[model samples]
Target: SGFLGFVALNSEFPQVNPAGSVLLPLLTGLFGAPVLLISAFSNSSNIPRQERRLAFPSVFAALKGSIAGFFVSIFPGISSGVATVVSSIGERSDRGYIVTMSSANTANAILCFFMLIAAGRTRSGASDALKSLNLVPSFQEIAILSIFSGIVAFLLTIFFGLLIAEKIEKIDGRKLSLSVLVFLTAIVLLLTGLQGLAILLSAIPIGLSTHFLGVRRINCMGCLMVPVMIWYTG
Candidate 1:
Protein backbone atom coordinates (compact mmCIF):
# COMPACT_ATOMS: atom_id res chain seq x y z
CA SER A 1 0.00 0.00 0.00
CA GLY A 2 2.82 2.37 0.86
CA PHE A 3 4.52 1.54 -2.41
CA LEU A 4 1.26 2.09 -4.26
CA GLY A 5 0.88 5.45 -2.58
CA PHE A 6 4.41 6.39 -3.58
CA VAL A 7 3.72 5.44 -7.17
CA ALA A 8 0.44 7.36 -7.21
CA LEU A 9 2.12 10.46 -5.85
CA ASN A 10 5.17 10.25 -8.05
CA SER A 11 3.67 9.07 -11.30
CA GLU A 12 0.24 10.69 -11.31
CA PHE A 13 1.39 14.17 -10.39
CA PRO A 14 3.03 16.04 -13.22
CA GLN A 15 5.34 18.39 -11.43
CA VAL A 16 5.75 20.87 -14.27
CA ASN A 17 2.04 21.37 -14.98
CA PRO A 18 -0.52 23.14 -12.85
CA ALA A 19 -3.52 21.08 -13.96
CA GLY A 20 -1.81 17.82 -13.08
CA SER A 21 -0.61 19.20 -9.74
CA VAL A 22 -4.17 20.22 -8.97
CA LEU A 23 -5.28 16.63 -9.52
CA LEU A 24 -2.59 15.24 -7.22
CA PRO A 25 -4.65 15.22 -4.02
CA LEU A 26 -7.67 13.70 -5.70
CA LEU A 27 -5.63 11.01 -7.43
CA THR A 28 -3.72 10.19 -4.31
CA GLY A 29 -6.91 9.75 -2.35
CA LEU A 30 -8.53 7.71 -5.09
CA PHE A 31 -5.61 5.34 -5.55
CA GLY A 32 -4.77 5.12 -1.86
CA ALA A 33 -8.15 3.74 -0.84
CA PRO A 34 -8.10 0.55 -2.90
CA VAL A 35 -4.41 0.02 -2.26
CA LEU A 36 -4.89 0.09 1.48
CA LEU A 37 -7.90 -2.17 1.25
CA ILE A 38 -6.00 -4.75 -0.81
CA SER A 39 -3.00 -4.59 1.51
CA ALA A 40 -5.23 -5.13 4.55
CA PHE A 41 -6.75 -8.20 2.98
CA SER A 42 -3.44 -9.62 1.75
CA ASN A 43 -1.68 -9.14 5.07
CA SER A 44 -4.54 -10.77 6.90
CA SER A 45 -4.43 -13.78 4.63
CA ASN A 46 -0.67 -14.30 4.58
CA ILE A 47 -0.48 -15.62 8.13
CA PRO A 48 -2.02 -18.99 8.88
CA ARG A 49 -3.41 -20.04 12.24
CA GLN A 50 -0.88 -22.75 12.98
CA GLU A 51 2.11 -20.50 12.85
CA ARG A 52 0.53 -17.39 14.32
CA ARG A 53 2.19 -17.11 17.70
CA LEU A 54 5.76 -18.28 17.21
CA ALA A 55 6.18 -17.86 13.47
CA PHE A 56 3.95 -14.92 12.57
CA PRO A 57 5.97 -12.10 14.05
CA SER A 58 9.22 -13.28 12.55
CA VAL A 59 7.54 -14.01 9.24
CA PHE A 60 5.86 -10.61 9.19
CA ALA A 61 9.04 -8.79 10.06
CA ALA A 62 11.12 -10.74 7.57
CA LEU A 63 8.61 -10.36 4.78
CA LYS A 64 8.17 -6.67 5.46
CA GLY A 65 11.89 -6.04 5.51
CA SER A 66 12.44 -8.22 2.46
CA ILE A 67 9.79 -6.32 0.52
CA ALA A 68 11.27 -3.02 1.56
CA GLY A 69 14.65 -4.26 0.42
CA PHE A 70 13.23 -5.32 -2.94
CA PHE A 71 11.68 -1.92 -3.55
CA VAL A 72 14.83 -0.17 -2.47
CA SER A 73 16.92 -2.18 -4.87
CA ILE A 74 14.43 -2.05 -7.70
CA PHE A 75 13.45 1.64 -7.71
CA PRO A 76 16.98 2.96 -7.63
CA GLY A 77 18.08 0.72 -10.47
CA ILE A 78 15.01 1.65 -12.51
CA SER A 79 15.47 5.38 -11.96
CA SER A 80 19.17 5.15 -12.65
CA GLY A 81 18.70 3.11 -15.77
CA VAL A 82 16.04 5.48 -17.02
CA ALA A 83 18.24 8.47 -16.35
CA THR A 84 21.20 6.84 -18.06
CA VAL A 85 19.14 5.97 -21.10
CA VAL A 86 17.74 9.49 -21.33
CA SER A 87 21.16 11.00 -20.98
CA SER A 88 22.63 8.65 -23.58
CA ILE A 89 19.93 9.47 -26.08
CA GLY A 90 20.27 13.18 -25.51
CA GLU A 91 24.04 12.93 -26.02
CA ARG A 92 23.69 10.62 -29.04
CA SER A 93 25.99 8.12 -27.36
CA ASP A 94 26.11 4.36 -28.03
CA ARG A 95 25.01 1.59 -25.65
CA GLY A 96 27.94 2.04 -23.29
CA TYR A 97 25.89 3.38 -20.43
CA ILE A 98 23.29 0.67 -20.85
CA VAL A 99 25.89 -2.06 -20.87
CA THR A 100 27.59 -0.67 -17.78
CA MET A 101 24.30 -0.37 -15.94
CA SER A 102 23.37 -3.90 -16.91
CA SER A 103 26.65 -5.28 -15.63
CA ALA A 104 26.27 -3.44 -12.35
CA ASN A 105 22.73 -4.67 -11.95
CA THR A 106 23.79 -8.23 -12.62
CA ALA A 107 26.52 -8.01 -10.00
CA ASN A 108 24.10 -6.63 -7.48
CA ALA A 109 21.67 -9.40 -8.22
CA ILE A 110 24.31 -12.07 -7.70
CA LEU A 111 25.39 -10.45 -4.44
CA CYS A 112 21.83 -10.32 -3.23
CA PHE A 113 21.40 -14.03 -3.97
CA PHE A 114 24.45 -14.90 -1.93
CA MET A 115 23.32 -12.67 0.90
CA LEU A 116 20.07 -14.57 1.11
CA ILE A 117 22.05 -17.77 1.32
CA ALA A 118 24.12 -16.42 4.19
CA ALA A 119 21.03 -15.27 6.02
CA GLY A 120 19.71 -18.81 5.71
CA ARG A 121 22.81 -20.09 7.48
CA THR A 122 22.31 -17.61 10.28
CA ARG A 123 18.74 -18.78 10.61
CA SER A 124 19.96 -22.36 10.94
CA GLY A 125 22.13 -21.32 13.84
CA ALA A 126 19.17 -19.62 15.47
CA SER A 127 17.09 -22.75 14.96
CA ASP A 128 19.72 -24.84 16.68
CA ALA A 129 19.46 -22.52 19.64
CA LEU A 130 15.68 -22.98 19.66
CA LYS A 131 16.14 -26.75 19.71
CA SER A 132 18.45 -26.56 22.71
CA LEU A 133 15.84 -24.53 24.58
CA ASN A 134 12.93 -26.79 23.49
CA LEU A 135 10.68 -23.79 23.07
CA VAL A 136 7.99 -24.17 20.44
CA PRO A 137 4.41 -22.98 20.17
CA SER A 138 1.46 -25.19 19.15
CA PHE A 139 -0.57 -24.77 15.95
CA GLN A 140 -3.71 -23.61 17.78
CA GLU A 141 -1.75 -21.09 19.75
CA ILE A 142 -0.08 -19.90 16.59
CA ALA A 143 -3.43 -19.35 14.90
CA ILE A 144 -4.84 -17.35 17.78
CA LEU A 145 -1.70 -15.22 17.98
CA SER A 146 -1.65 -14.58 14.25
CA ILE A 147 -5.23 -13.35 14.21
CA PHE A 148 -4.73 -11.23 17.30
CA SER A 149 -1.55 -9.69 15.93
CA GLY A 150 -3.15 -8.91 12.62
CA ILE A 151 -6.05 -7.18 14.35
CA VAL A 152 -3.65 -5.17 16.47
CA ALA A 153 -1.62 -4.14 13.44
CA PHE A 154 -4.76 -3.16 11.56
CA LEU A 155 -6.00 -1.04 14.45
CA LEU A 156 -2.61 0.60 14.81
CA THR A 157 -2.60 1.55 11.15
CA ILE A 158 -6.03 3.12 11.52
CA PHE A 159 -4.96 5.04 14.59
CA PHE A 160 -1.85 6.29 12.89
CA GLY A 161 -3.82 7.30 9.85
CA LEU A 162 -6.12 9.39 12.00
CA LEU A 163 -3.21 10.98 13.81
CA ILE A 164 -1.53 11.82 10.54
CA ALA A 165 -4.69 13.35 9.13
CA GLU A 166 -5.20 15.47 12.21
CA LYS A 167 -1.67 16.78 12.13
CA ILE A 168 -0.99 17.46 8.46
CA GLU A 169 -2.97 19.63 6.09
CA LYS A 170 -1.12 18.15 3.14
CA ILE A 171 1.19 15.19 2.43
CA ASP A 172 3.88 17.08 0.52
CA GLY A 173 6.35 17.59 3.36
CA ARG A 174 5.63 14.19 4.75
CA LYS A 175 6.34 12.67 1.38
CA LEU A 176 9.73 14.35 1.24
CA SER A 177 10.63 12.92 4.64
CA LEU A 178 9.40 9.55 3.53
CA SER A 179 11.55 9.71 0.42
CA VAL A 180 14.64 10.47 2.47
CA LEU A 181 13.85 7.70 4.90
CA VAL A 182 13.34 5.29 2.03
CA PHE A 183 16.71 6.22 0.56
CA LEU A 184 18.50 5.60 3.87
CA THR A 185 16.52 2.47 4.41
CA ALA A 186 17.55 1.30 0.95
CA ILE A 187 21.18 1.40 1.99
CA VAL A 188 20.51 -0.71 5.07
CA LEU A 189 18.44 -3.11 3.02
CA LEU A 190 21.17 -3.40 0.42
CA LEU A 191 23.67 -4.29 3.11
CA THR A 192 21.30 -6.88 4.48
CA GLY A 193 20.79 -8.15 0.97
CA LEU A 194 24.53 -8.75 0.62
CA GLN A 195 25.36 -10.74 3.74
CA GLY A 196 23.17 -12.96 5.97
CA LEU A 197 19.92 -11.02 6.12
CA ALA A 198 18.23 -12.94 3.33
CA ILE A 199 18.80 -16.24 5.09
CA LEU A 200 17.58 -14.69 8.30
CA LEU A 201 14.43 -13.65 6.50
CA SER A 202 13.85 -17.21 5.24
CA ALA A 203 14.64 -18.56 8.67
CA ILE A 204 11.67 -16.59 9.92
CA PRO A 205 9.38 -18.86 7.92
CA ILE A 206 11.28 -21.91 9.13
CA GLY A 207 10.76 -20.80 12.72
CA LEU A 208 7.08 -20.45 12.09
CA SER A 209 6.90 -23.83 10.41
CA THR A 210 8.64 -25.49 13.33
CA HIS A 211 6.41 -23.92 15.96
CA PHE A 212 3.17 -24.55 14.14
CA LEU A 213 3.83 -27.84 12.36
CA GLY A 214 5.35 -29.61 15.37
CA VAL A 215 8.63 -30.00 13.53
CA ARG A 216 11.94 -29.45 15.20
CA ARG A 217 13.25 -25.95 14.62
CA ILE A 218 16.73 -27.33 14.05
CA ASN A 219 15.48 -29.71 11.39
CA CYS A 220 13.42 -27.07 9.66
CA MET A 221 16.18 -24.51 9.84
CA GLY A 222 18.74 -27.02 8.57
CA CYS A 223 16.51 -28.00 5.68
CA LEU A 224 15.96 -24.43 4.60
CA MET A 225 19.29 -22.83 5.47
CA VAL A 226 21.89 -25.49 4.79
CA PRO A 227 21.16 -25.74 1.11
CA VAL A 228 21.23 -21.98 0.78
CA MET A 229 24.62 -21.82 2.43
CA ILE A 230 25.96 -24.67 0.32
CA TRP A 231 24.69 -23.13 -2.87
CA TYR A 232 26.08 -19.73 -2.02
CA THR A 233 29.46 -20.92 -0.84
CA GLY A 234 29.92 -23.55 -3.50
Candidate 2:
Protein backbone atom coordinates (compact mmCIF):
# COMPACT_ATOMS: atom_id res chain seq x y z
CA SER A 1 0.00 0.00 0.00
CA GLY A 2 2.82 2.38 0.90
CA PHE A 3 4.60 1.47 -2.30
CA LEU A 4 1.40 2.02 -4.25
CA GLY A 5 1.05 5.38 -2.57
CA PHE A 6 4.54 6.32 -3.65
CA VAL A 7 3.85 5.32 -7.22
CA ALA A 8 0.65 7.31 -7.29
CA LEU A 9 2.31 10.38 -5.79
CA ASN A 10 5.39 10.25 -7.97
CA SER A 11 4.60 8.51 -11.20
CA GLU A 12 5.65 10.29 -14.40
CA PHE A 13 2.68 9.30 -16.44
CA PRO A 14 0.26 12.18 -16.62
CA GLN A 15 -2.67 10.00 -17.59
CA VAL A 16 -3.65 9.87 -13.97
CA ASN A 17 -2.59 13.49 -13.49
CA PRO A 18 -3.62 15.30 -10.26
CA ALA A 19 -5.65 12.33 -9.16
CA GLY A 20 -2.43 10.40 -8.65
CA SER A 21 -1.18 12.37 -5.69
CA VAL A 22 -4.59 12.45 -4.07
CA LEU A 23 -5.11 8.73 -4.65
CA LEU A 24 -1.75 7.86 -3.09
CA PRO A 25 -2.75 8.37 0.52
CA LEU A 26 -6.29 7.14 0.02
CA LEU A 27 -5.28 3.88 -1.64
CA THR A 28 -2.50 3.47 0.89
CA GLY A 29 -4.99 3.70 3.70
CA LEU A 30 -7.53 1.50 1.99
CA PHE A 31 -5.16 -1.30 1.17
CA GLY A 32 -3.09 -1.11 4.35
CA ALA A 33 -6.01 -0.94 6.80
CA PRO A 34 -7.02 -4.46 5.79
CA VAL A 35 -3.65 -5.92 6.70
CA LEU A 36 -4.04 -4.69 10.27
CA LEU A 37 -7.59 -6.00 10.43
CA ILE A 38 -6.55 -9.39 9.04
CA SER A 39 -3.59 -9.56 11.38
CA ALA A 40 -5.85 -8.84 14.34
CA PHE A 41 -8.38 -11.41 13.23
CA SER A 42 -5.77 -14.05 12.58
CA ASN A 43 -4.13 -13.42 15.92
CA SER A 44 -7.45 -13.81 17.68
CA SER A 45 -8.73 -16.86 15.77
CA ASN A 46 -8.86 -20.50 16.95
CA ILE A 47 -6.14 -21.62 19.33
CA PRO A 48 -5.63 -24.14 22.13
CA ARG A 49 -6.43 -22.50 25.47
CA GLN A 50 -3.10 -23.47 27.06
CA GLU A 51 -0.96 -22.24 24.17
CA ARG A 52 -2.97 -19.04 23.78
CA ARG A 53 -2.07 -18.10 27.33
CA LEU A 54 1.66 -18.05 26.57
CA ALA A 55 1.74 -17.29 22.85
CA PHE A 56 -0.07 -13.99 22.43
CA PRO A 57 2.28 -11.59 24.21
CA SER A 58 5.42 -13.28 22.94
CA VAL A 59 4.29 -13.21 19.32
CA PHE A 60 3.15 -9.63 19.69
CA ALA A 61 6.61 -8.45 20.77
CA ALA A 62 8.32 -10.38 17.98
CA LEU A 63 5.92 -9.05 15.34
CA LYS A 64 6.20 -5.51 16.66
CA GLY A 65 9.91 -5.40 15.97
CA SER A 66 9.73 -7.33 12.71
CA ILE A 67 6.92 -5.22 11.21
CA ALA A 68 8.60 -1.98 12.27
CA GLY A 69 11.85 -3.03 10.61
CA PHE A 70 10.03 -4.15 7.48
CA PHE A 71 8.21 -0.83 7.05
CA VAL A 72 11.29 1.24 7.83
CA SER A 73 13.20 -0.50 5.07
CA ILE A 74 10.34 -0.54 2.56
CA PHE A 75 8.93 2.99 2.91
CA PRO A 76 12.16 4.87 2.32
CA GLY A 77 13.13 2.78 -0.69
CA ILE A 78 9.73 3.16 -2.33
CA SER A 79 9.52 6.90 -1.69
CA SER A 80 13.03 7.56 -2.92
CA GLY A 81 12.71 5.46 -6.05
CA VAL A 82 9.35 6.94 -6.96
CA ALA A 83 10.52 10.49 -6.37
CA THR A 84 13.64 9.95 -8.46
CA VAL A 85 11.73 8.47 -11.37
CA VAL A 86 9.07 11.17 -11.29
CA SER A 87 11.62 13.96 -11.23
CA SER A 88 13.55 12.39 -14.06
CA ILE A 89 10.56 11.96 -16.37
CA GLY A 90 9.09 15.36 -15.56
CA GLU A 91 5.41 16.25 -16.23
CA ARG A 92 4.80 16.06 -19.95
CA SER A 93 2.39 13.24 -20.77
CA ASP A 94 4.96 10.46 -20.58
CA ARG A 95 3.15 7.18 -20.03
CA GLY A 96 6.17 5.03 -20.78
CA TYR A 97 8.04 6.41 -17.81
CA ILE A 98 5.43 5.36 -15.26
CA VAL A 99 4.73 2.03 -16.93
CA THR A 100 8.41 1.08 -17.03
CA MET A 101 9.00 2.21 -13.44
CA SER A 102 5.96 0.33 -12.15
CA SER A 103 7.11 -2.76 -14.00
CA ALA A 104 10.49 -2.51 -12.38
CA ASN A 105 8.88 -2.28 -8.97
CA THR A 106 6.76 -5.35 -9.69
CA ALA A 107 9.81 -7.27 -10.83
CA ASN A 108 11.76 -6.25 -7.74
CA ALA A 109 8.90 -7.26 -5.44
CA ILE A 110 8.66 -10.66 -7.12
CA LEU A 111 12.41 -11.23 -6.74
CA CYS A 112 12.31 -10.23 -3.08
CA PHE A 113 9.38 -12.56 -2.44
CA PHE A 114 11.31 -15.44 -3.97
CA MET A 115 14.40 -14.58 -1.94
CA LEU A 116 12.37 -14.58 1.25
CA ILE A 117 10.83 -17.95 0.41
CA ALA A 118 14.29 -19.38 -0.20
CA ALA A 119 15.69 -17.91 3.01
CA GLY A 120 12.69 -19.21 5.00
CA ARG A 121 13.40 -22.76 3.85
CA THR A 122 17.01 -22.51 5.07
CA ARG A 123 16.12 -21.35 8.61
CA SER A 124 15.01 -24.71 10.02
CA GLY A 125 15.81 -24.00 13.67
CA ALA A 126 14.15 -20.62 13.62
CA SER A 127 11.15 -22.13 11.86
CA ASP A 128 10.91 -24.82 14.48
CA ALA A 129 11.06 -22.24 17.24
CA LEU A 130 8.35 -20.19 15.54
CA LYS A 131 6.16 -23.26 15.14
CA SER A 132 6.57 -24.24 18.81
CA LEU A 133 5.63 -20.76 19.98
CA ASN A 134 1.88 -20.18 19.61
CA LEU A 135 0.82 -16.79 18.26
CA VAL A 136 -2.68 -16.16 19.51
CA PRO A 137 -3.20 -12.70 21.00
CA SER A 138 -5.82 -13.86 23.53
CA PHE A 139 -5.55 -11.73 26.64
CA GLN A 140 -7.46 -8.45 26.78
CA GLU A 141 -4.49 -6.47 28.06
CA ILE A 142 -2.21 -7.94 25.43
CA ALA A 143 -4.67 -7.15 22.67
CA ILE A 144 -5.10 -3.59 23.84
CA LEU A 145 -1.36 -3.04 24.05
CA SER A 146 -0.84 -4.47 20.60
CA ILE A 147 -3.46 -2.16 19.09
CA PHE A 148 -2.15 0.84 21.03
CA SER A 149 1.42 0.19 19.98
CA GLY A 150 0.38 -0.09 16.33
CA ILE A 151 -1.59 3.16 16.52
CA VAL A 152 1.33 4.97 18.15
CA ALA A 153 3.75 3.71 15.54
CA PHE A 154 1.40 4.65 12.72
CA LEU A 155 0.93 8.17 14.06
CA LEU A 156 4.65 8.54 14.58
CA THR A 157 5.36 7.46 11.02
CA ILE A 158 2.87 9.99 9.64
CA PHE A 159 4.30 12.78 11.79
CA PHE A 160 7.88 12.08 10.78
CA GLY A 161 6.98 11.55 7.14
CA LEU A 162 5.22 14.91 6.95
CA LEU A 163 8.15 16.61 8.70
CA ILE A 164 10.57 15.13 6.20
CA ALA A 165 8.35 16.04 3.25
CA GLU A 166 8.20 19.65 4.45
CA LYS A 167 11.96 19.86 4.82
CA ILE A 168 12.59 18.26 1.45
CA GLU A 169 10.10 20.59 -0.28
CA LYS A 170 12.20 23.59 0.77
CA ILE A 171 15.33 22.23 -0.85
CA ASP A 172 16.39 23.39 -4.34
CA GLY A 173 17.15 20.22 -6.27
CA ARG A 174 19.41 22.10 -8.69
CA LYS A 175 21.77 22.98 -5.83
CA LEU A 176 21.70 19.54 -4.23
CA SER A 177 25.02 17.74 -3.90
CA LEU A 178 25.57 14.84 -6.28
CA SER A 179 28.81 13.66 -4.79
CA VAL A 180 31.16 10.79 -5.51
CA LEU A 181 30.98 9.90 -1.80
CA VAL A 182 28.04 7.61 -2.48
CA PHE A 183 29.81 5.90 -5.36
CA LEU A 184 32.97 5.49 -3.33
CA THR A 185 31.02 3.98 -0.42
CA ALA A 186 29.26 1.58 -2.78
CA ILE A 187 32.58 0.56 -4.31
CA VAL A 188 34.10 0.02 -0.89
CA LEU A 189 31.16 -2.12 0.17
CA LEU A 190 31.31 -4.12 -3.04
CA LEU A 191 34.99 -4.79 -2.56
CA THR A 192 34.64 -5.80 1.10
CA GLY A 193 31.12 -7.22 0.86
CA LEU A 194 32.24 -10.86 1.01
CA GLN A 195 34.31 -10.16 4.12
CA GLY A 196 31.30 -8.55 5.77
CA LEU A 197 29.18 -11.55 4.79
CA ALA A 198 31.74 -13.90 6.32
CA ILE A 199 31.84 -11.85 9.50
CA LEU A 200 28.08 -12.10 9.84
CA LEU A 201 28.13 -15.82 9.15
CA SER A 202 30.69 -16.37 11.92
CA ALA A 203 28.85 -14.14 14.42
CA ILE A 204 27.18 -17.04 16.28
CA PRO A 205 30.36 -19.10 16.41
CA ILE A 206 32.36 -16.07 17.57
CA GLY A 207 29.87 -15.49 20.39
CA LEU A 208 30.05 -19.16 21.42
CA SER A 209 33.85 -19.01 21.38
CA THR A 210 33.83 -15.89 23.55
CA HIS A 211 31.35 -17.50 25.95
CA PHE A 212 33.64 -20.55 26.25
CA LEU A 213 36.46 -18.15 27.08
CA GLY A 214 34.25 -16.63 29.82
CA VAL A 215 33.81 -13.42 27.80
CA ARG A 216 30.51 -11.66 27.22
CA ARG A 217 29.00 -10.32 24.01
CA ILE A 218 29.43 -6.84 25.46
CA ASN A 219 33.11 -7.53 25.94
CA CYS A 220 33.42 -8.64 22.32
CA MET A 221 31.63 -5.49 21.20
CA GLY A 222 33.99 -3.36 23.28
CA CYS A 223 37.02 -5.15 21.86
CA LEU A 224 35.84 -4.45 18.31
CA MET A 225 35.15 -0.78 19.12
CA VAL A 226 38.61 0.43 18.17
CA PRO A 227 38.66 -1.38 14.83
CA VAL A 228 35.13 -0.26 13.99
CA MET A 229 36.06 3.29 14.90
CA ILE A 230 39.11 3.14 12.65
CA TRP A 231 37.04 1.71 9.79
CA TYR A 232 34.51 4.51 10.13
CA THR A 233 37.25 7.15 10.23
CA GLY A 234 38.88 5.74 7.09
> What global local distance difference test value does model 1 have?
0.35
Residue 149 shift from truth in candidate 2, angstroms: 14
lDDT of 1 at 154: 63
**Model 1: ten consecutive residues of lowest lDDT:** 47-56
RMSD of each: 23.5, 25.6
Q: What does the lDDT read for residue 84 in candidate 2?
A: 25
- Which parts of model 1 have CA positions greater than 4 angstroms off? 1-137, 171-234
Report the lDDT of model 2 for residue 109.
Answer: 32
In terms of lDDT, which candidate is strongest?
1
Angstrom error of the Cα, residue 198, model 2: value is: 24
TM-score of 2: 0.21
When summed lDDT is taken over every stretch of 10 residues in candidate 2, the lowest stretch is 48-57
Top TM-score: which candidate number? Answer: 1
lDDT of 1 by residue, 71-103 (tens): 323322122223233333433323344343443
Q: Model 2 over residues 66-103: C-alpha lDDT tens digits?
A: 33333322322232233224333443333444434443
